[model samples]
Target: MSTALNWLSALDHPEFLADRVSAALRQWPDGDAEAVQVAEIDPAIADTSALVAATDITLESSANCLVVRARRSGTETLAAVLVLATTKADINTAIRKTLGARKCSFMSMDAAVEATGMEYGGITPIGLPQDWPLLIDERVVAQDQIVIGSGVRRSKVRMPGPLAQQLPGAQVITDLAVPIA
Candidate 1:
């Protein structure tokens, strides 16, 4: 099976991802070689591995965007991160150090949306408020193309992996740990 979308129109509430696609296109109009397409998925496809498996795509080629909960002082913050499916964030050390917080932990769903202005399972690095901090795992760059959340859970965006690191406030590093089998 391939990742082509034969039913783009069948996507429910496409606006969730449409707005993000529109913004990304306008920003990288001269870049991204592949045409951006929205692949409709069942709402239950929330995990990266599940999305890849459903689309018959390889996990290494999928950019798994994750919402991490972090705490600074008494206030908690949600950090949006993009990494390869084969890895997991080093939350207690790397992420906390990056944020320069005495304490940091993954935020809940409600906290994620309230802080990022994107819905749960829909939050993406692109089009995030300019001030939002994004940490991208370098493993993502090793792939030719990466599939990432298109600001919605119902769909994902297929784009070049390298370009993902260029979004504003995006930092690329190998701070995350490789996922265990």
Candidate 2:
């Protein structure tokens, strides 16, 4: 954990973590030392741009989790995609091909919240449904640290970049996200 930032142990802030995030952290290997730090923030600033402006974090160090839906032959596949705030997921091309779906789009806010059981604007990849693939942009894994959602709107989770690779069903994909000009 970085000594510069004020970070609370994930174990100490159940109220700030989504139920699934808390449970996952509890089971994470202690030897991995990549401890996830929870930091309380105003819900109003939970969005990436606002969060960066309001806190010490930077836009490059913040990752956004988005729920993408793909449909094929009446079967719907939902995936949780994590991308750095400075880029956008290539949903129309890369993700669509990976999902093997003819159509793909961002999941509706209502459906995303209902399926993840997390608040809108606070969906982290940690507690996603087991069946859903967790697509992590390669750029995100290259960072030393990042701030991500805590499954709720009042807090954020900070952890080592490599730690995201340990997430269930997580797949690091190059070009998963395209840089934004």
Candidate 3:
């Protein structure tokens, strides 16, 4: 069990996790899933700011997984961007260039939900579509533990930050985001 998540309980209710997220955790090669903990919460507090205020998790230890669209030559692709709660992904510059797209921007809630089969505000990198690139900021990977979406707004997942790199298609990129002042 992760010592950092003393504030959270073990997986009390498996139903709290999204289907894909549960599967992903169970597939962890090192049994790292055993170290993960989850907590059920009101959907209203599932968003980052409210989650921080409603629980012991701090902003620094929380990560936000966003869905962004990359478009080039009329072709559109979707990718997941994971950044620390205190930073915003540099979508227009860094991401667009990295994705080799003429345009890159956050995807609409409806599109993201339909594409990922995860509720908005709870789309985690753990269960993203394999074809969809999952970009993780260096800062987020540096955290000891991170609280992120559980694929459902009713709960959240907390795991060692580095575990994010282990996701099937995750790519650790430097300067993926800029600190929010």
Candidate 4:
């Protein structure tokens, strides 16, 4: 859990990355651009649970992205599931229905990593392939701000949840049922 470098700053040409997210922010229309921030941690060393536990931030206020792969007949596709950190996405039923596949399941870790060109813990919706499906949990919209993977494990980015919904190729959904607290 102990860490050394600032994770977020590890990105190459961070200013350029900021500019990209900034451009997307401008299109948000109702978004508060100030909500986004870059934080650092050991992305490669931790799973979502460990990453969340290592931070002082509230779990309910963060969003996690899970890269999922589903197959229909002989065709294989990739989808990203976004959910509140306090909850987990229901990939079995929800994702299957969305993909209209009689059978849907998660891809192997190796395939997910290869498809997204992102390390497992660092996958985000911002710069994913256009063909990948993006599914977001409805609860994310209820938050004022949410933390998400910054496309790299050692770093994270925070922003208005809706902004994440509006990313190109993103399709927000409430398929995941939030467990009663």
State TM-scores per candidate: 0.80, 0.94, 0.92, 0.77
User: What residue pairs are clashing in model 4?
Assistant: 7-40, 7-154, 43-153
Model 1 agreement with the true structure over 1-181: per-residue lDDT tens digits: 5454443321333464747445655665553523444566776775676666666767777776667766767876556678877787777788788877778677787876776666677677777766667888888876777777777677666667888777877888786656747
- N/CA/C clash count, model 4: 3
Best by TM-score: 2
Summarize candidate 3's per-residue lDDT along 1-181 as a digit string, tens digits: 1113233533445687888888777677656777788887889988998878767789999999999999999999889999999998999998888899998889899999998899999999987888888889999989999999989998888889998988887999999999999
lDDT score for residue 67 of model 3? 95
Per-residue alpha-carbon lDDT of candidate 4 for residues 1-181, written as tens digits (9 for 90 to 100): 5343243321333542333343444454443444556776654544666765676656787687777767888887778878887876777788778877767766677887787776667766666776777888888877887777666666677677767766767777775636536
| Cα-based lDDT at residue 54, candidate 2 | 68
**lDDT per residue, candidate 2, 148-169, as tens digits?**
9999999899988889998889
lDDT (C-alpha) at residue 33 in model 2:
35
By lDDT, is 2 or 3 better?
A: 2
lDDT (CA) for every model shown?
A: 0.68, 0.88, 0.86, 0.66
In angstroms, the error of model 1 at 110 is 1.4
Model 3 quality (TM-score)? 0.92
Which parts of model 3 have CA positions greater than 4 angstroms off?
1-12
